[model samples]
Target: MLKKSELKDLVLEYGKKFLFPDFTNKLTWFVAGVGGAIILTPTPLKLIIYNWLVDSANLNSGTRFTLAELAPDAADYSVGVVLIIGALLHNIANRYLVYKEKKASSHDVSGQTNQIDKELFKKFLEDFPSNSDSIDMLRQQDFSNSFNIFRLANLEKFVEEWDTVEREFLNTDLERMRRELWEACYTFNYKLSMGAYDLNGGPIFSCIPDAYRGTDNWPAHVDEKIDELNGLSTTCFKLYEEFVRFGRKSIA
Candidate 1:
């Protein structure tokens, strides 16, 4: 639950968002306010215009002001009412359009995720005929070895798979995973090419690898990288489990 102040702030924020979706909306309301007041209020300018019209009509001898004389009044705010309603309708329309666009974008991302999930399942099945065996293979693998994780899981292939999905279909999570995995793979290759570490070490950062041989605070840096890779590994495993679940449900 929110406190009174927090609730008030939230309400004000949303109200402002609704009323002023953009600068153009602010300008629209400004014009509406000034124009409506001018047209609706019995101001000097309006009276002058009205009197001029009446005088022009009386100048024609054949035409006489025969009706009961009445003063122009806008106390009822008729024009202001119309302007307010128009502004409200415009704001509603803008919000509705934004809502529709976001909904459609969400749907597109969902469809893409489903498609990728099915593809991953198919790939896993191809690698291991038995679903249980496929899962066992994933479970038994070492995640601490970032290189092994990259190679065994064929992270590059999945990264490419994302490329096939339209850019617009890629959501934040998907893009993030792809970028992190790609970086892991790229960093491994870069280190190997630079001869920073020998191939005999198996590219595991269990200790101060050759890459950080002379560097100060290497342990902390290595630990940080290890944790980062560990996170990616965990995310990959969770995704695989989700794929299995999705596949089972689809088959059922």
Candidate 2:
């Protein structure tokens, strides 16, 4: 009963709530806090060095000594202190960045997982045979009459062809035709899910393969046709599983 725009809005809202700005903000704060802590510790040491130079060494004036008179010991001590501070800063920054990245990655993964779960639930509802009554009601609506009549007519024709195949070639072509029918159904359902057509009328027939009209070698080629259709059906089902399950699990 949900409108296409409503469904889209829901998806966007969930994505924003469970997936975006907050995760990025937390990561930024973590990095800033670690960097600040590491950098602030070096300030006291710098002050201590300045005090020793001015009071203990009595070297208040700028022109009091040359570079050689400064002594390598003090220079070495200063260099060592700077290196230690830089090293700590680098470590903190690296760790913070890595942790943030991992957290963001996990959030993305969980988002994808939830999306797949939602999509599968939708497909289950669509594929359920009992839901056909609801679809029928939708088709009967005044809004549906404007654009969906053609698709409905085509679906009727397709069902008739399906019935004919079931009756005449039940033994030979039934399995193949069944597979094709399922594929057509799946394609139609996917197009609906993507909102590729108007709510009232969609390009369902355009998404389907042409009806089987071959008459030559009807008996001999029946098995081959069935094999081909089954192959296609299997592939489509596999695609569903991959996108709906395996791929999502990988991200999670």
Candidate 3:
């Protein structure tokens, strides 16, 4: 009964963890070898690079480009194209599995949180150990508490903990935007739970299954919080996408 957006976020973030962290490191040498030849001998190697680049017989048409189309000299053009593509692939790979601050990371920066949430959420749904007692617990409205805090704490110290990350390496603006929306949702959930006896993150207007919300006791201005909470969730996802896209472009 999970909403469409929840499913998309879970699947994408889950899939990201599987990406190889060393993808960029491995690809660098290939680009450097070809790129060095082009930079040092731009004109002479044009024909050779042009032949290798447009060798469609060996590779499929996955964003294929030619030296002529890329630059004045085919060699230089191919080098630019290769470097551009290699950079993008590396960016995705890095974000998907980059876990540098292992000792320093507290909560938000943990590389595997997204993947852990996915597994925990799925297991919660598919409970198997108990016969009746656990099944009854799953039916409770506050079942979300059985899982981890998928959202982050709003304190500045949480973000500061990640100071080990270079400013250039992390998208500070995009991460900040996401953090703002995440804090908005987290705060809203906290206030909502106080008025109605529910678990911390339970009864989120936008994310809760329609069946679950109908049973829970909501506040007078329920629509207002729903509107705000749903808006915050949407903004958070948009900011996350921006983080990934901007990282691809910014990685040198």
Candidate 4:
């Protein structure tokens, strides 16, 4: 099994190389060539070309192949697969760059980018707790906190809570702090979720009503999402403290 950081590195490396890669790049050519080959093979159109070759050679007509050599379904399926994969790759690269740019451009009170904030970035890299033990120390927990732990039903309410944080809590006029907090939330959000899509609150689910539309079990897994959001919220606060507690103060 691949280590998490190694896997992340692989994804970023390949995502950057193959998604809208320069024409001269080998990985770009490889993706195009492989995708083309996949679509062209197991297709009748290829058989027609082969037949032309056979006839041109005129060696013999003893080939046992029939006219239906190409499988139409296979061609259509390959096209769809290639298109979906290509679209996802392009999207992944775009999102990665957006997050990188957001974090990189953020500055300290001394006007240094967040990237050079070694201790803060180190904290950013640290793994958060799996259980709520740390959270328990920070605040009081009750039935309501665990009530949605694994939502058996009532997806609407679960998503409503999520949207409240994303829209109301995150939307702010404090330009620097707001942007930094958002980037922190999004970074944690992306790391926790396994899927390729951003899934980072506002970017993934604009509102409560729309959260469950594309998913199969927002109602069932609502609790896990709640857990994620809570964890991200905690991390966002820590990131803010890193700015305030340290001598950084605020953006220059």
Best by TM-score: 1
The pairs that clash in candidate 1 are: none
lDDT of 3 by residue, 5-102 (tens): 99998988666544443444555546555555555665646665556868863478666555444444433455656775765676665655455534
Superposed Cα deviation of residue 48, candidate 2 (Å): 18
Question: Candidate 4's error at 211, in angstroms?
Answer: 82
What TM-score against the true fold does each predicted structure earn?
0.39, 0.29, 0.25, 0.22
Model 2 misplacement above 4 A: 1-91, 94-98, 101-109, 112-116, 119-122, 125-252
Off by over 4 Å in 1: 1-31, 34-36, 39-45, 53-74, 128-243, 246-252
Please give, for residues 1-252, the per-residue lDDT of candidate 4 as tens digits.
999999999998887655555545566556666666656566666666667876765556565543345555544456546754885576567667867767766533224433334443333223222133332322332211322222211222222233333322111233345356546645544543432222343232221224554555556455555565556556665655553444234321
Q: For candidate 4, what is the TM-score?
A: 0.22
Tens-place lDDT digits, model 1, residues 129-215:
334432343445432332332234344344345344443222344445445544544444343333223346553323246565556
Candidate order (TM-score): 1, 2, 3, 4
In order, what lDDT does every prediction score?
Answer: 0.53, 0.44, 0.45, 0.46
lDDT: the better of candidates 3 and 4: 4
Alpha carbon deviation, residue 47, candidate 2 (Å):
18
lDDT by residue for model 2 over 1-252, one digit each (tens)? Answer: 999999999998776544333423554445555545444545555555555666645555545542233332332344445555554565566567667879999988768656654554343334432235323523343221223434344333333443443222212232343445545545544433342234324443121212322333334344453444344434544443333343234323
In model 2, which residue pairs have backbone atoms overlapping below 3 Å?
none
Report lDDT (Cα) of residue 73, candidate 3: 46
